[model samples]
Target: MSRRWLLCLALLPCAAQDVIQDWIREIEQSGGGQVLIARAGYDAEANEIRLAPGTTRPELFAEYLHQLAFVRELMAAQALTVSRQTPEEGPLHLILINTARIAGRRDVEEAVIGHELGHAWLRTLGYPAVAAGNSVANCLAIHATDAVQHILIRKELRRRGIDAETPWIATLNDALDQWKVRPLPAALTPCERIQTASQWVDVRLGLDEARWPRITGYEAQLKTRYPDIEQAVSGLAAYLAGQDVAEKEVNRRALLEAVRRLRALAPPTTPLKTNQ
Candidate 1:
C-alpha cells in the first residue's frame, strides 16, 4: 500500500470516536448513567473568560468539560483545586487555540485534551504524595510519564494497522525525539524542569513499569476494552526502533482538526499555566 494509504489506515481508529461515543451512549442508554464529569459553574463576580471564534468544536468542548470534571474529582480526592480559582470563584474560563496553527486533527485534539486533562488531574491528586528524596526527580518522573503515554498511544495506533506515515503518528514521534535531546532551561524550576525532562525520556524509553502500579492497572483496563491496542503499539514501537517513516501526509487537514480539539482543552497559554 502507498504511504498515504497507511496514514489513512492509522487514523481510522481515531475516526471511530463516534463508536466510542456510541458506547458511552449505550451506558447511558442502559441506565448505567453515572456522572463522573463535572461542569464548571457560572460565576457572576469573576471575569467571563471568553474564547476566540477559532475555538469551536462542540464535541471537543464537551469532552474537555468531562476531562475537567475528572481532574476536579482527583483534586477533590486530595482536597485541592486545579486552579487558584474555584469553578464558582473564577470567570467562565474557556480554552482558546489557533485551530489553524496546531499539527493534528479534531480527534488528535481530543487525544491531546485527554492527555492534558490527565496532567491537570495529576496536579489535583497532589504531587506532595511523591515529594520526597528529590522533588525534582519526582516531578520529572510525573511529566516524563505523561509524555511517554502520548507516544504509547501512537504506538497503539500502529498495532491496529495504522501506518506511521500518518501526520499524527509522525508528528507525535517527532515531538518525542525532539524532546529527548532538548536540554532543560536553567531558569526553569528544578523540580518542574526535571519532571519535563523525565517525561521526554519516558516517551523515548516507555513508562517505568516497575514504579507505578496504577499505570499498569490503567493500561490493563484500556487494553481490556481495546484488544487491538497491543498490536497498534507494537507496530509503532517497532517502527520507532528502526527509524522508519511508514506514512506520509494522508490527511493533513484532518490532522489539523485533531490538534484544534486538543487546544480547546489546554490552550497553549503564556508562562505555561501549571496546576494552580
Candidate 2:
C-alpha cells in the first residue's frame, strides 16, 4: 500500500509535465515551426515592468509568451504579417505592451491589450471599419475583455452610492483586478451568466442601448447557440445607449429567463476525471 501510494504521488508531477508538453506540442503544430517570439529591445517603459529576477516563476513568462505565440498563430492562420515601416494592412505589430504605470496590474494590461487585439482580428475578418471611440468600438472593447471588468467596476461604484458616470482610475484598477479573478458559477447558463456578470457596466455606462446594435451585429459571427440570451442582453446594451433604462430592465429580465432555460437544458459541471 505504501509503495502504491508513493507511485501515485510520483505520477502526479509526470502528469502535469505531460500536460505542459502536450500544450507546447500543440503550439508547435499550430505555428508550423515559423513562430518566433523574443524579448527584443525594451523601451524605458518596458524596462519598468519589474517582475523580480530569478524569484519570479518562469511559468508566468511562459504563459505570456504562449499568448503572444497564439496571436502570431492567428495571423499565420489568416496568412498575414506585421508590416513595420510599410503601410500594408495585414497582421498587427507584435507588441509586448509595457508601460510603467501599467505595472502590478495584470488584468488591465490583459483587458486593454486584449481589446486592441480583438480590433486586429476584426479587421482581418473584414467588417465596416469604425473608429475606436465610436459606440461600436467601445462595445468591441468591452466584449474583448468579456464585459467582466466593466460590470465589476459599475457594481463597486453603485454599491458605494457613487455615480457611475464619474471617471475614477482607482476604481477602474480595482475593477480590473476583480474581473481577472472572478469565476462564473457552473450553475448559471452562459448567456445569463455573461449578462448577470455584465449587469453593472450595462446599467452604469448605458451600454445596453448605446452598444446593443453593435453587440447584436456580433452574434452572426459567434459559433455558439446562445443567440437568444446574447440578443436579449444586446438589446439591453442598445437601450443603455439610448438611455432607455426601462427597456434595458425589460431586456435584462428576458435575458435572465433565457439563461434559466439554458441551465435547465444543461447542468453546468466539470467532467469526471479518468485514470488512463
Candidate 3:
C-alpha cells in the first residue's frame, strides 16, 4: 500500500481500518489490482474528476473508508474517488461519493456510498450501458438507467441491514417542502425535467411503500408538480416493478427498456449543450 493509503487507514477507527485492509487484501488476492483512493471532485462544467480543495486528503480518505467498511461488496471496485461535489457518478468500477452531500452524517454517508457501490456492483455484473453523444442525452441516459438499478440497489442494501430508505425519504420530503414554498417554474428544460423526475423515480422505486406508506403521497405530489414527465416516470416505474427477479438477464433487459423509455421523454431536437 502507498503512504497515503496507510495514512488513510490510520485515520479510521481500528475496526474499520482492519475491515478495509481485509477487503483490500481479498481484492489483491483475487487479482483485482491494488485499491486506489483519492479525494477528488467532479467539475460538472468540464465533465471530469479532479482533486478538490477544502478538506484535507487524510480526512477525506478516512471518511470514505469509514463508510466503505459497511459495504463489503463495494470492494469489487479497484478504485474509489470521494468527492465533495453533488450528484455522484460511478463509471464501471470507479465509484465517486459526494461527501458534500453527506456532510459528516454517518447514516447518510453509508446509504449514499452503498447506493453508489451498488452501481459499481452492477457494472461488474455486465449491466447494460446507456449510450448518448451529448451531455443532455447522456444525462437522460444516466437517469433512465438508474431508474432500474435503484431497485436492485435498494434490495441489496436491505439484505445487508442498511437503512437506505430513510435518507432518501428525508431528502425527497425536504425538496418537496422547499419546492412548495417557492414553486417550480411553469416550464422546465428537458435536462431539468429528466433530473427532477429521475430523483423522484429513484425514491419511489427504492422506498418500501409497505413500510413507508406515505411514499404514495409523495408520488402523487411529484406527479402533480411535473405533469410533463409523468408518463415517462410512470412507465419506467411500471417496467421496473415487474423486474422482481434479480438475475443478470432480467436486470439487463429492464435497463434497456428503462433507458429507452427515458430517452423517449426528451425531444430529438434537444441541443448538445453541456450539463450545468
Candidate 4:
C-alpha cells in the first residue's frame, strides 16, 4: 500500500521557518512519514491545498525553500498528539494557511493553525465525520459540527496555555463596534440567521460572558437582530455545553444533536449561503 503524506503550507520569516521545521521533524520521528511543507491556497470545496491562480514557476520552486511556518510551538504540540494517538490515520498534516483569514497577524495565525490542528486531533479520536451529501446539507453539517468542536478545541487550547478566546473576543468586539455606528440589518434570510446564530453560539460557549460582559450584550443584540433563530441557537448552545468532551461517544452525540437542531431552523427548500 502506498503511504499518504500530510501537507502544510505558509509564508513566514526565517526564524518562524526554523521553528516549524522542528515541528515537521517531530511528526516524522513519531512514525508519521516524511513531512512536506509547501505554500498554496486552500480549496475548501475539495478539502485540500493546491497551487492558486497566477503563480509563477519560480514562486512554486521557491516555496519549497521557505517551507511554510506558523507562529509558535503549538503546531509541534498538536502534531505530536495526532502522531501518537492515531498513526494509522496517516502522517500529521497542518493543511493550508489562508493568510487572508489571519490578516497577516502571526499570533492570530498561530491560533488558526492550532484550531485546525485541534480538528485534526479530534478526527484521530474517532469524532464523527460530517456525512457526505449535497452542498446545502454538507454546509449545515460542517457548521453544526464546528459549533460542537469549538468547545472541545477551546478546552485543548486552554490546557496548552493558549488564550483561544482573545482572538474571537477581538473579532466580536469589532463587529459590535461597527453595529453601534451602523444599525444591523432589519432582517435576514433563514439561512443567514441560522449561520449567524451558530457563530454567536461559538463565541458564547468559548468565552465567559461574565468576565467579558460585552459577550452577554452581544447575545442580547443578536437575539434582537435574529429573533427567529434565537431559540434554536440557545438550545444548541445548551446542548453542547452539557456534553463531556472527554469521551469520543459524547462528542459524537453532541455533534449529531447539534446538526439536528440547526437543521430544524434551516429553510426547507432554499439553498444556504455557505461562504463565511
Candidate 5:
C-alpha cells in the first residue's frame, strides 16, 4: 500500500461527549499512562459498579468499563484517536472496525480498541514510524504490544473483582500469558510470522475468526489476509492475490475498501515481488 493508504483513518462514531472529556482528564491527570491503567476504581460491592448480566468474569461489566475509560484516555492522548485523515508524522494509526457492527461484548469490544491502543503505545516506545501496512515492523511491534496489553487487561480485571482461578479470564490470560514463554514461531514468509503471532489472542480464547469478531487477535491476520488492490496490477500481484481473506461481509467489505485505496497507491511495480 502507498503511504497515503497508511495515513488514512476510518470514521468512528462519536462516543458520548461527557464520557470523552471525563476520561481524557483522568488519563491526563493520572501522571503516566501505565498509572492510569493500574489504578483501581470503585469496589464491586459499591453501588457505582455493576457487572454485566449473564456473566460474572467482570470483563463484560466493570472490567469493560474500566478498559473503555482507559481507551478513552488513550484516544485523547492524540495517538489512538481514529480520524479520516492521517498525520505526516505521529504514531502509526490504529485500524478499528465499526464498533457497533462488532458484537456488543464489552471485553471483546474494548480489546479491539486495546489492540489498536497497543500500536499507539508502541509508537511512543520507538516502534518504526511507518504506516500500519509495514508488515515486518508491524508484526514484531504488535506481538510485543499485545503481550503488554495482556498484562494490563488481566491485571485490571483482577483489580475489579476477578480471581486468578476464574475459568474464562484465567484461560484467557493463560493463553496470552504462556505464549510469551514459548519460542516465537520463526518467520518463514513476509506476513506469515506476523499472522501467527496475531492469532495467539483469538485462538486461545476460541473466538471465531470466520464470523469476523472485532477482537484484536485478528489484527495482523486481517492485515495480512486482507486484500490489497496492488495485488492485481503490481508485480507482487500474485502474493497479494493469494491471500486467504475473511469471507464475512462486514469484515470483507473493509478489506475490499482498504485494498481499493492501497491499489490507488500501488507503484508500477509492487515491492512484494520475488527477486525484486
Candidate 6:
C-alpha cells in the first residue's frame, strides 16, 4: 500500500472530530480567517451552512462548503457573475452552481475552479448559450467539467507530491464522505441516480488510471452530442487546463481570457439589497 494512503487511513478519525465547531469559531472571529468566510449578503447566522446527516465527514464537508460559498460570493463581488437568463441579451447574472458529489479525493479548490470552467465549457457546447444554470442537463455537466479539470492539472498536483484528492479525506471513512447527505426530497430519481453514478465513476476511474487522460473519453461523449462545440471549445479547455505556476504562461493567459470573457459577457447587476 502507498504510504500516502496508509497515512490517510490513520488520520481519518481525528478529522471527524469537531469540524463544524472549528469552522464556526474561525468565521466568527474578525481577521483573515473571518475574511475567509465573510461576504456581502452572507448572513453568518443563516449562511455559514451545515453538512447534512449523510456526508462522510461533516467537518470536512462543512469546511469545504464554507469555501465554496466564499468563492461564489467573491466572484459576484468582483463582477464575474457567470450568466444571463437567455443568450438574447439581457441582465447577465451569476451562474447557478448546483452542488454535486465528488466520489473521490480531489480538493475543494479544484472542484470550485472546475465548476466555473464547466459553465464556460457548456456555453461552447451550445447547451443554450443561456438558460444553462436552470437546466437539468446542467446538473451532470457541473460534475463532468470538474472531472475534466482534474484530468488537466493533476500532473502538476502529483509532481509536487500533493495528494490529488482533498486532504479532508484523511478524516472521514464512511457515508458522511459521500455527498450532500440533498434537498427536501433527499432521494434521487432513477435518472438522477444514473447521472450521479456516471460522473462519480468518471472521476474515480480517471484518478485511478495514471496513464489515461479522462478528457479523451469525455471529448468523445461531447463530440457525439455537440460536434460543433467539441471542435471549438476543446482547444480552449485544453489551453486553460494545462496551467502551471510559471510566469507569463500561455495557459495562464488562456485562463484569464476565459474568465474575462465570462465577466465581460455578464449583465450589469441591478442595485438590490436586503437581509437574508
Q: What TM-score do all the candidates reach, one by one?
A: 0.30, 0.24, 0.67, 0.67, 0.29, 0.31
Q: Which lDDT value does model 3 have at 168?
A: 71
Model 2 lDDT tens row, 1-276: 332233224212433333323332343354322111112122456632232233223343334333443333222121112212223422323323333334434333333333333323322323212111222222232232323223333443344333433323343444445544873233543333443424433443534335343333233323143444455455444443443222434334433333333333333342211111
- For 1-276, candidate 6 gives per-residue lDDT tens digits of 532233234212334323322322332342212111111223357854443333332342233345553344332221112433334433222322222323233344233333333333333322222112322333222323333333443443444333434432322222222322421133444324323333333334344334434434443443454443333344434444454423324333433343332222222233111101
Deviation from truth (RMSD, Å), model 4: 9.3
Q: What's the candidate order when arranged by decreasing TM-score? A: 3, 4, 6, 1, 5, 2
lDDT of each: 0.33, 0.33, 0.55, 0.56, 0.32, 0.33
Clashing pairs in 6: 55-176, 55-177, 56-176, 56-177, 57-176, 83-93, 92-267, 105-165, 105-166
Backbone collision count in every prediction? 25, 13, 0, 0, 0, 9
Best by lDDT: 4
TM-score of 4: 0.67
Task: List candidate 1 stretches off by more than 4 Å.
Answer: 1-16, 20-104, 113-187, 206-276
Candidate 5: tens digits of C-alpha lDDT, residues 201-276: 3233333445334335434433344334113223222222343322233223323333333334322122221100
Q: Comparing candidate 2 with candidate 4, which one achieves the higher lDDT?
A: 4
Worst window of 10 by summed lDDT in candidate 3: 70-79
Candidate 2 runs further than 4 Å off: 1-89, 94-98, 130-276
Local lDDT at 133 for model 2: 28
Model 2 lDDT-worst window of ten: 76-85
Backbone clash pairs in model 2 (N, Cα, C under 3 Å; residues 3+ apart or in different chains), count = 13
Q: What is the lDDT of residue 265 in candidate 3?
A: 65
Name the candidate, 1 or 3, with the larger lDDT value: 3
Off by over 4 Å in 4: 1-94, 189-191, 267-276
